[model samples]
Target: MKNKFTLILVLFLYINLVNCDYYQSKTIVPHDLPNKVTHLHFYYFDIHTGNNPSAVIVARPNQTNEKNPKKSSLYGTVFAIDNPLREGPEETSNVVGNAQGLYVSSSQSEDVTLTMYVDYAFTSGELNGSSFSVLSRNPVREPTRELAVVGGRGKFRMATSFALIRAHFLNVTTGDGIIEYNVTIFHY
Candidate 1:
């Protein structure tokens, strides 16, 4: 009788062990990858002047003159932008989003570069309420600039990618310009 009881106990323990292993195998998590990629195209208006401008010069460096003023850098200068992102180059075009942030002239040399930190927040279309953050250096004179997409929110969550900003139009005297942007984002 004692040997039969011992055999039953061992059988029960074996069954519990098998069940535990089965449950554990079922609980294994699936791997998440940044496999999805998407492209977004928009136009950004750099409005530095007018009564109601989109971008404004918030700070500037002390007066300094270089032999070639045009070759001089805008170091220590800062600008704040809440620029409208539109479907077309015209400001009258339908507003899709807004690029809001601050960019500072970080280059201490002759290059007119800005250390940019901006968030593109959408207000219309499929990506409404979604936004992505950009943190990179922008050489304004470059015909095509690539900026890194650090992260994002909403549909863009866990995203990483780049943005191609090309010169669309420029007004030298007014410091107003229109830029074409093509952003590619990857996410889980």
Candidate 2:
């Protein structure tokens, strides 16, 4: 009787533990932006997922490991308004991660269009596809272009999306795989 009672208690505890919810803060995460822009816009590139836990991933390499075959670097670009009144002399700059401030000219004011291209290479086994999600800040009245493209080498597919001001994304997969994305954002 004691053995049965203990078994039931253990089973009950196990059920509770296994069913525990995995959750994070419900707040939306905004992408890091540069300081220099009078006007700013963001776009959605892709939504993707993995087939299994070990499939898709993103990573950066250390300096010493840069020469290693398994090592790779990711890159992106950004554009900002140019002003003459600003302290800086450059008319325009490529906005990279963590870059601060936009260039402004003193007497000459111009509305500038910035373009950014993003790329990264990572290791993955099985991949599903890329995904994009609309956030509260997304522009509503604009026409959006959406397309899905599967790669030839890796088990990957990228669903590229063009939205005026949306940035949320979710990735889903069909099989176990990994993918590297090359993204470009341009305004003219």
Top of the candidates by TM-score: 1
Q: Worst lDDT window (10 residues) for model 2?
A: 81-90
RMSD of 2: 21.2
TM-score of each: 0.77, 0.16
Which parts of model 1 are misplaced by more than 4 Å? 1-34, 66-73
lDDT against true structure, model 2 = 0.26
Residue-wise lDDT of candidate 1 within 1-188, one digit each (tens)?
Answer: 99999999999999888878555655533244437888999999989888999988898987676676665446888999999999999878999999999999888776578899999999998899999999999998889999999999989987899999987998866779999999999876
Residue range 1-188, candidate 2, lDDT tens digits: 99999999999999987887755336543334222211223222221232322222232223343456573322211113111111111224221211112211111112222222222122221222222221112111223322222121122122223333321322322321111122332211
lDDT score, candidate 2, position 3: 100
Residue pair clashes in candidate 1: none
